[model samples]
Target chain A: MPEIILIDDPADPRVAAYRDVRERDLVGREGLFVAEGEVVLNVLARSTLCEPASLMIARKRVAGLADLIARLPEDVPVYSASQEAMDAVVGFHIHRGILALGRRRAPASAADMLAGLGEGALVLALSGIANHDNMGGLFRNAAAFGVDAVLLDTDCCDPLYRKAIRVSVGAVLVTPFATAQGDLLEVLTAAGFETVALSPGGATRLVDLKRPSKAAVLLGAEGPGLAASVLARATTVAIPMATGFDSLNVATTGGIVLHHLAFAALRD
Target chain B: MPEIILIDDPADPRVAAYRDVRERDLVGREGLFVAEGEVVLNVLARSTLCEPASLMIARKRVAGLADLIARLPEDVPVYSASQEAMDAVVGFHIHRGILALGRRRAPASAADMLAGLGEGALVLALSGIANHDNMGGLFRNAAAFGVDAVLLDTDCCDPLYRKAIRVSVGAVLVTPFATAQGDLLEVLTAAGFETVALSPGGATRLVDLKRPSKAAVLLGAEGPGLAASVLARATTVAIPMATGFDSLNVATTGGIVLHHLAFAALRD
Candidate 1:
């Protein structure tokens, strides 16, 4: 069982890393990330892609989470503090009372991840998705649709951002993803992926597009959609929508396209 | 052309409806709703279902939006204020510089809204969806997929709430919706509709389900998905997700289901 340490003061050096979470998130956490709430904490405990560094819980929550705490590795420390102290340490009022510090494993290179996929793998590639909520939503949808991996262009926001992780309901913890080192499209092409870029003005309707054995679906931010150069190389597909309406939210677009690809793959 | 009136005081009576927007949204706005940003204001301008009650814009924005303001009905009042004064009036920093108070045409009864649908109509029914962002997202997806009308059970939040309208990117203004007065499912059934409820343990996979002539897809809040009683009465359909994963976000689920129904209808 992991050791339960009682912490009475917010300034305890042992819990120093948990200080001012919101501000720290705006800066960087070195190589670590904070996971909040019971749901995400549970995901961190069970996640193979990331490891929980430590846990801090409200003293009142200790009894309720005893079973979960007992399951933690012996090396992991569990700190119990008064809700007031917990709030002070975190620099915010987090009612959920459960927070975990997590460290992600070294990520594989984008090329390596793509090359390692099975012949029938489906991948989601994101470009310039600046909104953390959109980033999280894309990962949540990608995981739901069983995409083998996610590749992010350099301009995309970090999936492990506190808000993104929370918004994704812990999907960013479990989903395998890598940041692209070079041109994302070129890398995909070299790895044998039949790339499809989703845009409003596309040549093929999503309903009529044929699925490839190995495919990557690309999505960009809401306003400036996929780059023209990227669209030039990939099969451009559109999800038919009411005329004159702007494109669906990028994450919603991801869900629709991923579902179509996943369902098509399942049916055949 | 609409007249532009400048106000230097934050407490001006003419703009009282725009005061403390975040708090006002909670207290209810009588018969009015606030739409923010240029995008939604533009939608409100063109919307046939909702009329612009007034416009409050930052003084700096007046020049750039002159053409748009000129297109508005001369009867609608346009109020302009300095950015500082506008921020004071709204109780927050609304950098968007555009705000429109809109009055919805008295909504149609759920029965009448459903009864008026085309023979080949697709409707989205929502229950217990209390989150404003999800509510907005569902409406946005409904609009994107050409859903004829949205039926919201009593438990659902108002899609016209300021935040919901913002997250929906103005889709809420253009979509037709009704609040269900009686048992939602019973009303749906009475409208010559075949209802489908989405859940993790659904009886049919979304891929294999045959489309009906006029269908209503029901989605519930994330934790307590469609009431078991409703699920029992409707054809329960599941979007096949990865094993052991929880259900997708309610709005994401709406996008997938609506896309499927809309696309299937288009093909046949």
Candidate 2:
């Protein structure tokens, strides 16, 4: 069981990492991120890829989370404070009453992550998805559909951003992902994966796509869709849409395409 | 052509409807709602169901929106203001540089809206969807899949909320919708529509669902899925998901189910 430390003061030196969470935005730079709420904290505790550095909880919530606390390694510190003190530390009312600080394992190259997957793999590759909300939603969908791994270009936003993690409901913690610079399509193609790009103007309709033994679906940000060069290099697929309507949200689009690909692979 | 009226004062009575928009939440109660941005303004101007009460544009954007202005009816007042005045009127930076006040027509009953759809209709029925962002995303997906109409239970949030309208990219203006305080499934059933409820425990998988000549998919809010009574009354459908994962977002769920239904109907 982990050690339980009682904290009465918000200014306690040990809780400095939890101060002004919204203003800090401390996720990617130092391999550290925060998992908020009971559900997310549970997932973080059980996640194999992420390790909890420490935990903080409201005094009232400790009894409810005893089983979870007992599961943590002895080296991990667990701190409990009054609701008022916890709020003062976080600079906000955290009604969820539980939070865990996590550290990501060493980074993996996109190629190394993909090479470990078994045959008949389905992956989601994204470029220019700078919006944190969309990034979170995409990770959530990726987990739901069982994508083998997610590949992100350097231009994409960090999936571990606090809002992104919250929006994903902790999916970001479990889904294996890698980010790198350069041509994402060329890398996938060299890995013997069928590359498909989603665009408004494309040669093939999304529903008509046949399942491939190895596949990667490329998605771009909304407004300015997939770069023209990316579309030119990959097999372009379009969702049949009503005339005069704008494209669907990027995350929603990813969900639809990924759902189709997932089920199609099952049939094959 | 709309008559252009220049106003230097932010407190002018003509633009009172667009004041303190965030605090006022004025949409359906007084038959007035505000539309922002160039694209949404254009959609509101052309909508046959929603009529514009007046339009306010930044003085700099007036020349750029000349063609859109020409399309507006002469009776609709077109007010132009300096950027500073426009920001002061809306209580924030009106970066989009455009705003239009719209008045909703007499609401059609759920039955009336369903009755007006053509044969082989596809409809979306939402219950207890109180979040404005989800409501907006649902409409955007509905338009992308060419849904015939949308029916909302009385518990659902107003789709015309300013945030929802903006998030939907103005799909709310073009899609026919109605809200009533009763069993939405019964209304759809009475209108000769097949009803399907999406739930994790659904008896049939979504991919296996056959297209019906007239169908409506029932979706409830995220956490407490569809009410038991509603699920019992309609055909329950599930998306095949990986083990140990939670359900997809309600709006993303709608996109996948609707995409399948739309294509299946075409094949039929």
Candidate 3:
């Protein structure tokens, strides 16, 4: 068990990494991935692939978390502060007083991910998914349905963005992903992945979705979604959207298609 | 068309509704609700339930929009600006020169919605689903499938919040949503709605979804999700998440579940 350090002062430089957490709303030098709440922190600390740089817990809430904090690496700092100071450092009220920050691992390259996954599996290929929270949600959906991996094209938000890390509930850390080169279509083509571009207005219906030898689903940002070229880059498929209604979001669409694939795979 | 009041000046009070578009981000005020692009504005124009107080478009974009804009009574202002001034009013650059500002409609009541829905139809009831975008996505999914209507609890973020309305492609305006008075369990139960609470850890698997007499699904906010009391209020059904994943967002979960209900109803 690592000994917890008591620092009631908000000015302690040791806790500086957690300072003004709301400042994360604006862009910053990206490296450290910030995680919120005990659930995400516990997931990070426990994952063999993730190691926390430090942990912060308000003294009042420390009793329930002693067991989890005890397991941190001996040198990892566990700073204890009054709830007030913790709140000040984070720049807003945090009901869950405990938070953990971890170092960002270099993401695998697209070629490496393709090599690792081998031949046939359904995976997510993201384009222009600029919102960090939406990016996280997309990853969360990908992981929830066991997509082989995610291939992020250029212009997508960094998966390690702090809000993304928090929003994913650490699922981004678990879901294997890579920064793919070139447009989504070209990458999938070179990798021998069948690109399936999802569209609302396209002629194909979702009920007609068929399993491919190696499938990669391409989704664009919400509203002004996948650029026409981005759409042009794939063997397009349309979800069976009801008439007089709009379509599912990119993230939700991923989940539905992934679930559909999973079901078909089981029957096969 | 209400004589195209073209103003070159950004300060023209006629376009006051379009001024300071981003101010809503800094503070919540009753004055903010924006609909963007032609598709959304068309829904607004056709909706007798909600009126667009005004419409804004570039002189060229207005060519095909004449009959749509003409439907508004003459006094209801249809403001236009040179493309440059319109950009100035919106803060960030927007190519969707056609915009409209409408008086926020009075929120509809929940009791009426429960009574109004068909006995065997689907309804999506949202609990504390605060993210404006998630609400938008949920509406998109609801409309995409054949869900009867969206019923929001008291604690929800406003569906008509500018971002939600736009993200939903203005489906939020057309979808017959009504805010309920009591807790979801009480209002929905009193109206003979069978509540299906969605949880990742839920024991009852979705593959076994039954044809219900009348159905409403209660989805919680992302992360901390449905309160225990709320979960207790419904017959719990689990979306079979893949190995090692937590769950999907409120909207995606709603979409998948609605898909099942739609299938069940269609088969029946």
iRMSD, all candidates: 1.2, 0.9, 1.6
Tens-digit per-residue lDDT, B1-268, candidate 1: 9889998899899989899988988888998999999989988999988999999999999999998999999999999999998999999998888999999987788998999997789999999999999999998898888888999999999999998998888889988999997678899999999898999899998877778888999999999887788888999999889875664889989998888888674324
Ranking by DockQ: 2, 1, 3
Question: What DockQ do the predictions score, one after another?
Answer: 0.76, 0.83, 0.57
User: If chain B of candidate 3 is superposed on the true chain B, what is its TM-score?
Assistant: 0.91
Report, for all candidates in order, the number of backbone clashes.
0, 0, 1
Candidate 2 residues lying further than 4 Å off, grouped into runs, are A26-29, A265-268, B26-29, B265-268
TM-score, chain B only, every model?
0.97, 0.96, 0.91
Best by TM-score: 1
Off by over 4 Å in 1: A265-268, B265-268
Candidate with more favorable, higher DockQ: 2 or 3: 2
How do the residues B70-178 of candidate 2 rate in per-residue lDDT, one tens digit apiece?
9998899999999999999889999978999897777678889998876789999999999998999999999888998999999899999999999888999889899
Candidate 1, residue B96: the lDDT equals 83
Chain A TM-score of prediction number 3: 0.91
lDDT of 3 at B183: 86
